[model samples]
Target: MSYKTILVHLDTSVRAHPRLETALQLAKRFDAYLIGLYAVFEPNARAFNVMAGSAGYYEVQAAMRRERAGALERLFHAELTRAGVSGEWLAPGEPADRAVPHHARCADLVVAGQDDPGDPESYIGESFREHLIMSAGRPVLLMPYTGFFATVGQVPMIAWDGGREAARAVHDALPLLKAAGRASIVTVDTKADDAGPRIASADIAACIARHGVEVEMVSSVSDAQASAGDMLLSRASDLGADLVVMGGYGHTRLRELVLGGATRTFLESMTVPVLMSH
Candidate 1:
């Protein structure tokens, strides 16, 4: 398997350039068609109109949004031309929470940046990363908010949970893993009451072996002080892993996403590129 089409979600965020650069490198490596998507989220104006607002204010707000979108489009085109890669720009009027996933479904992979929790105006909503990973039905390559990643999928570390989500992530990452020089599968065993049935990590390693990846299995027990996600990152750092493969886990509550503990922790302090699937 190979990536033939790559979709990158870009916006007014400062991190968009680095994320685009990474996507361009990946596209060039795979000779894939790159699609740049810029989505502008419109606030709910109906609520504002009830208080002291008029239709005139709404029109002004929309005009400002259009101007921002136009600026983003110009930036996108300039970068695409400089890169000299086969690509297209898409600026959709819909909110990013819905529009990104819709456009990502047709791409082999989606590239995006990790949201800055403190930035209220983050191009991608603070929670949109997890939401898109769950809804896109494709693999998402997420770049941390503060870092420069010139290469990825070279040496990967897989966080294995032996669950459906983990399995799906491993499957989705087959193309990258197969191309990597080496990979390590890290599994952490916790002492929780409902930890589910035990599974051998070697079995998963054997399956990956068929794909010609130089793979190894590492296992550890998680303690109260350090969670599974912490252990995984520690191992990744020790092994100098450039890419991490894992599952994105979350549940919707009252239309909001409540992520699993490990999933949340990983995103909050991620130090390397992560390929996640739900």
Candidate 2:
């Protein structure tokens, strides 16, 4: 159940050292190949490069880009050479949101930061995780802010939804769930929907049962006190959960997750690791 091909999709903004270190450790333990992915969104690039045209500017910018890629590869190679660290450099040309999931397609797992520390709020507002979970056909391991952590998938929580996203997350996270000692299916009740949770919970339980992993079902009210995302996280924290697995709700342009206020809050402030799928 150990992951062999691990892809850590990241932004140029994140300091590469810590993420590289974490990936190296995992690679050493699992003898896995780490794919370090960096995507340049066309819109973001255009917005960033707006200025009077100058040869020096283009040259310097191009150098910086190459340097970032080289630095990431060199750093990973150096650390991994001490053990079994086989990794490759991935620079996807599509928009960041699109490229990440494409990288995830061939990967057993995709990793990313939960929040961009520089912005602090809004969870990157990019739907990056959402895109991967919904379309990657794989599992995504979302590292919480400030990246340094021990092994993930230790104590996990499954966010139950009857949709394809939740199903894929559970399937992809099989390695984690099988390794976990304590895990549960946490769902919240929406004002207008009562049957969705029950159906989702049953489906998730059945899915896990197929893998011989028993998951407890924890249901809460997505109420006025907090959004659905916040409530589930709080419940997980109360249960001393270390990781959460949930189906992402979102599309490309219009963020589908906004409909669920809870997901937004959880994405922004979740302290523990979250394995999200769309």
Candidate 3:
């Protein structure tokens, strides 16, 4: 039930170090294999060359990309050695949105940083986080860009919706739940059919109890003016939760990975580490 392999996305952005350090700490905690993945996109000048053909421009651009890749590779190895953690590095000549998800398929969990909306060059695009969570077929642990997380899974909040995606997230988070000291399972905006949610919450609590986790069930009715995500976050803050476990996008159609309301809210205003699956 433990994560045996962890894959982390790396880039040349300002927040990359925090993301990598967080991954390193998790790897050490779980004693798992850590893999650092970087994607470098080489600019294509074919469209420009359609009117003005120049092979030299493409060559120079390719050289610059290669140089940047080398620098990033060196940094990765240096950090890996200094940390003394078991890991490997992969730098593929593809877009991050593609390469990261490709490698993420085989990992037990993927670690990524929250996209900084203010930094246009923030290694990964803001939307790519949702894309990876939806496409990777694995659980993703996202670190907040504005905060530092030295450890995780001590106190967790589970956002329960009773959908397939939410169920998947709960199951995927079993390893962390099994090790957590305390946890809370909360449902937001439940239907008038309270019996079903009560039964479901009790069942989930029982399941986690078997894993040796102290679990509590919480039910909150959302205000008409506030979104479900906002309520969940507020509750999590009240509980002083360090980790959030929830589904990625259960209510809305992905349509090329466009996020739903709750999912988008988590991406935009996450204060703690989030573990999401779809």
Candidate 4:
């Protein structure tokens, strides 16, 4: 909503030029404090990074890591300087980049990149933007890897299921959606499903309508054999939806997101942008 402090989750992995640019624009618009945090994850886990081998090799490798980390900050800060974002950079020691959640606790909002467009093979690998939403303890706004969004929440798609997760996303998205000219809520095959999903969809639509939003609700079913993500994507495409706002449909058990059907499809194959809240 009217964010005063916005913490953008920066990646030192691939050059996040687009993400950095978008963050600066958002920071200027909200007139908020912009924190450009470069998370220094473990060296062992980085495929492109070299490991500390012998005593002789350790110094060289560590120095290279520090240089790369510094380079990333300089490039990012240059954009902030150009855009006048009022930003600060941080590279934590112990948890490295993993400490982003803790740092986000003090901010009103968190912004994270969606995927790396340069590396087709490793883009959005095990490292997903969804983790930011699930673990951030706050609503996460996922900035797309390729788009040029100066201000988010402009044209958004709302995933309506009448569930707690969907409700939270809607409440979290109100700041943006209320500012938009139009917002759409999507429900899959409300006509085919039993009373449960249908009722849930209706309830979600009704709840948001009370918010005084100029909204439209659409219910469409997949081809029956389509993947869950595919169905949602297809519907969004058909609606010409620019962004999708929904719950972070995650697994309740071990892996966080093992439910592994439509959710995984949506995460992987989405052509349109998504705004997920857990």
Judged by lDDT, which candidate is best? Answer: 1
Candidate 2's C-alpha runs over 4 A off are 28-30, 41-50, 53-62, 92-95, 117-126, 161-164, 191-203, 206-210, 219-222, 252-259
lDDT of 1 by residue, 1-278 (tens): 88999999887667777888899888888888899998755677886678675767877977876787788777777876777778899877677988999999999999998887665446555578888998999999999887777799888988887777788888889988987856899886645477577456788888889888888877663767888788788888898899999989888999878987778878888999999999
**Per-model CA lDDT versus the true structure:** 0.83, 0.67, 0.80, 0.66
Model 3 spans > 4 angstroms off:
40-43, 47-68, 123-126, 190-199, 250-258
1-278: candidate 3 lDDT, tens digit per residue: 89889998877667877888888777877888999998643445675477565677777766766776678778778877877788899987677888999999999999988878775446465368888888899999988888777678888999987766778888888888877756899875545453253336677778778888898888763788888888888998899899999889733355555566788899889999999999
Across residues 131-242, which tens digit of lDDT does each residue of candidate 4 receive? 6666776777665555455455676778765556677877877766776757887765423243353346667666667776777877654566775567777777787776
Summed backbone clashes in each candidate are 0, 5, 0, 5
For each candidate, C-alpha RMSD in Å? 2.6, 3.9, 3.4, 4.2
Q: lDDT order of candidates, best first?
A: 1, 3, 2, 4
Residue-level lDDT for 110 in candidate 3: 96
TM-score of 2: 0.78
What C-alpha lDDT, on a 0 to 100 scale, does residue 33 get in candidate 4? Answer: 86
lDDT of 2 by residue, 1-278 (tens): 77899887655556445555666666666678988886643334454456557545766766776677677666656666765678887775666666777777888777776656574221334566555556777776766665456766677887665655567677777877886745788765655453253355777687677777877877744578666777787787787777888766654455453424545666678778787765
Models 1 onward score TM values of 0.88, 0.78, 0.86, 0.78
